[model samples]
Target: MLPLESRRDMKIYTFENRTIDIRAYSSAGGLFTALAEIVLNKGGVVYGASFDEDWSVVHRRIDNVADICHLRGSKYVFTDINGCFSQVCADLKDGRTVLFSGTPCQIAAVRKKFGYHENILLVEVVCHGAPKKEYWSLYLDELLKNQGKTQDEIASINFRDKTKGWKNYSVCVEFKGGSRFIQNHRDNLYIQAFVHDYTLREGCTKCPFKNPNSKADISMGDFWGIEALAPNIDNNLGTTIAIADTAKGESILDSIACRTYFSVEQVAQYNPAIVKSPSVPLDKPEFDTTVKAEGFHYAAAKFLKPVFDSRDRKMSFRNQLRSFIYRVYSFIKNR
Candidate 1:
């Protein structure tokens, strides 16, 4: 196995004759701009998650390159491999150069299922982890209940909105009636709780892929604390940090245009601890047991309830406080 640390900071690597780097923040336009560079220089397909018409999840295949415009943003849902694995694997088998973007586990799953197809390039997010499916179900249920609408009435959802920043980061839920419900990230208790334990996959916490062992050529995530490191870069506009893990990864960076690339040394200097240490273990006990369990779904559902319930109470308290504040503000303004 390659020394895991070798792939820690974004470097470049080559896969299936194409080169691309995990990028630092590229604007909504920047994502497509980079993909366009890849397709024009070396014809290939781009695959990533996109929001469906109903705001559900689907794997997107962009052969024309222009279609990449559809998959921009941090909130493209359904990072789990369960729903979209077969389709993704099939595309890999087709032998076209493919850029598969997703959370690490989903990338790992595709790598495991398809093996290393020479033409496939895997790009993973620096994921905080994923929320439990139950939490999402309950959240949507609560939303529907509050709105007096059915699940089908929901049209789209955006989990992260840069216009609002993280605190005001809102989930925009649209309805069939053309009305929209903008729930602040804080208002979505289940989502907040889910973020805490979402990296539930057994192998993920131990994350063989967390380092260079990852099959992906490039890794992408928010350059948290970027301001401290790249004081020159305007993070307020949002930055996507890319860590190229291999030579092919480096080549991709060379190929892509529009992104303001930073050096690995600069990235390490910004996040000294990440450079100083080994990749952290996944750290969740439930994650260790779920994979070996007879039924992972049943086991996860059974084990995660207590954790979610405890969070629910805390969320409820916070919500009440918010409601009280809103009401007081309304009363004063009206008077």
Candidate 2:
């Protein structure tokens, strides 16, 4: 039998209404905004992942709406907890409501570390596994070199920048020089390898958290297939797919103002990460070997270009069909 955390008693929804300033990262139906507003209204604290000046993903405490807004968007890498659990417990014990978000493994770790707290709300992302921090560090260095900027000059970076729209997301990096670099996921070697699962951590391939039932009060992810399910709701900025896994989670959804309910099967069909782990990257050994002996750039050029090219071609063919499906789903959903 699946563990209790792996069980799926969830209510899915598409979040649409969003406040204006929060639109940047809240593109996916403003789920983060909704969550943030709830925490703020309760005078609670938010604990979520954000990037350091050096571009490493790490968890931090967010007290104000401005800081919580930073927690929007995906880091697309493994984030170290770095005592976030201890802090969350501390806040909850102080009678503050806490909204904690992370990958399912991180969520499980939080559960193991702190047991249960009524004031704490756990939100887990449908993760695609994590790559070693070393790989990301190296990739960032490569970006710095390409941009001719020092790590200290970096002002911000968004891995899931929606400038090109959601389906064709890009990485946008800002520097103190007022310079910005934006490149599509397919064009970026790091994202290419990431999306293909070539550089994921070992535990990810056999992750135990890939069950429909999760320990988190809520589960959230991009509504990747929203066009098919609710065409009227998708405007390309992004749409969010949120699942309330517990009664607490459900209650919070009931209180939120603007949202559209969806079926569990409809959501699961588009997002398998909710129930299954992705296959291990076939070229991980080669990637490891070449990356160790040569470097990230050389290894990526050699091992990843062909893979990315193939994916580009495949997606190109399917884009039209996917569009059709979205229209069909919208028709059905509205009717």
Candidate 3:
């Protein structure tokens, strides 16, 4: 029931020019990296999710600006906070500046635990609910098995590889031996699981942090439909949609060196998760059972069949319409 930007001073923003390398490494525009860089330049530390050696996403801390790349991109998998809350508290207690970015739930916990600390700035990713870590593990196992690789052979996993541009991003897996597996997002089973709600947590089906309730100073997400919403600024690469809830958030956004600023009111039209939780897929129960017994691919096969079928049906209809129009033109010309 809360308004989108409940605060009178809340503002929206998007990158004007382009962040070339930054956008390439990021899931969206490199706004998080920019914000972290600002904090680091001011002698502050940043806490956010990063992949560990085993590729499990977990919250980590870094004070150096160069390491911000490690924190970029989207990890749909669950991220273990791993006692980082206490570390943030320690930093704040010592009067050190801190920039923390996480899912709404994590940010809410930080806000509750730290309580409007002057030295701490809170940022939250506009999340579509996190999937279970176990699901991600299973998917990774299947991925490595299919690629004829093992845990030791893998170098890195990127859920959002913007090489083909960010709109329809790819899931990239780099091997230690120098080969890479870059699968289109449409074909990525893990993304399908996350998007279709098969792997999302039960609580995420009805998330508690929608709007007018978030304590985060800034909320950032991929502007999915920016091309249609704001065609002039659309680069077909990655563009970030940022909502600044406090003056501090606005100040941090202003510090982003080279970004064009613009406000959007209908962001939810593209990013629905901003205002509501994605409903649990009806087939999730079957999906879970199939995945647990057979594997991720097996479950995906049975479920994704409908998606392919729908696409085929739509294509067939379009083809039929085109043929009909051509025939009609031929008849008129002959007459």
Candidate 4:
């Protein structure tokens, strides 16, 4: 099969039929978890980004059904797995199927390390650029200080908490005692910085592995314009935009025992980020300076200026209009 961009018949879909629990907890439609299940069921080891003891995002290995939950959600911070690169190499050498997932660049690095191994399935997220882990640490420190809580008092931190619903996903800091802190993206500085691309790494500005370049088996992300693209399945729960680059990629997608839906054409305008690198916010340098001098809190308060999520509303309206015109054009052309 050709690259996702070069091929007109690229396989793209939302894993609507994925297990209910998995879909409910996932960042987007539980596609990764579903895929991970397939590999795990086959006795393969899955490697993915997960939060560590300090709530720092790091890539870890998952081999059992119980451990997949840890690798289930999205972590916006940068993660390096060079330490586990050799471990993955050993896993592959020992004739085990390895499902390695990460941001596009991390996938590229792993793909380079292993060359073209048939047993190694490279799955990359449609990354929005990884923010530096240092900033994430700073935010946690501030959150702890503000709440008068310590890291030990927290049980888990979910960046994509869907209690309010997927489209309006919030950040949830669950304490061990049962009480938790939840904040919507509108009020969440860390999420706003990530969404506005103000906290992303410098390399993400001109990402080399933009679209057709990543060459991973499967690339997935939140189906941003799902309301316009696949309305029937748009439950405001969660949906994923997925694309396959190679024949194996397509095969892996075909193996999914889920209600897959959509076409490549319907997905592109909805999620051009899969094809384009994240644009750098103009104040990123100043934001970085502020962050280094003060902290993520000060920098975010000063720089992350989003006007009441009007951009999301505007983008949705524009997507609906674009889809309407495309439908009209297609109807007339076919007639």
TM-score of each: 0.63, 0.87, 0.90, 0.87
Native-referenced Cα lDDT, model 3: 0.81
lDDT of each: 0.55, 0.77, 0.81, 0.83
Q: Over 4 Å off in model 2, which ranges?
A: 1-9, 257-261, 311-335
| Candidate 3 structure, TM-score to reference | 0.90
lDDT of 4 by residue, 213-261 (tens): 8758888888888788668778987877677767677777777633355
lDDT of 2 by residue, 1-335 (tens): 11234334445766655564455565365687678777977789888878876689888888887677678878877888957767876887788988888889988888777666777788888787777788999888987897788889888888878777777888889888688988988788888787678788888888987756477877877777777887886778777777777767777776773446566677768877777787876777888899989889888878887876787789987998899999999999999
**Residues forming the 10-long window of minimal summed lDDT in candidate 4:** 257-266
Clashing pairs in 4: none
State in Å the error of residue 284, model 1.
10
Candidate 3, residue 164: how far the Cα is off, in Å:
1.2
Clashes of each: 23, 7, 1, 0
Q: Root-mean-square deviation of each candidate, in angstroms?
A: 9.2, 6.3, 3.5, 7.3
Give the best candidate by TM-score.
3
Q: Higher-lDDT candidate among 1 and 3?
A: 3
Q: Residues 138-202, candidate 3, lDDT per residue (tens digit)?
A: 88889889889988888888999878878878999999879999988887778876887778888
lDDT of 1 by residue, 1-335 (tens): 12135434444221111222212113221343464446535767776767665445566666775565456556533455565566656665665577777776677777777665677777776655554443455456656777898877876566665456533366677777799887666545444444545433334345445544456666665555556655675435455566565556656655652244456556545443223322323544554365345334344445566666787898999999999999999999999
Q: Name the runs in model 4 displaced over 4 angstroms.
A: 1-6, 257-265, 306-335
| Ranking of all predicted structures according to lDDT, beginning with the best and ending with the worst | 4, 3, 2, 1
TM-score of 4: 0.87
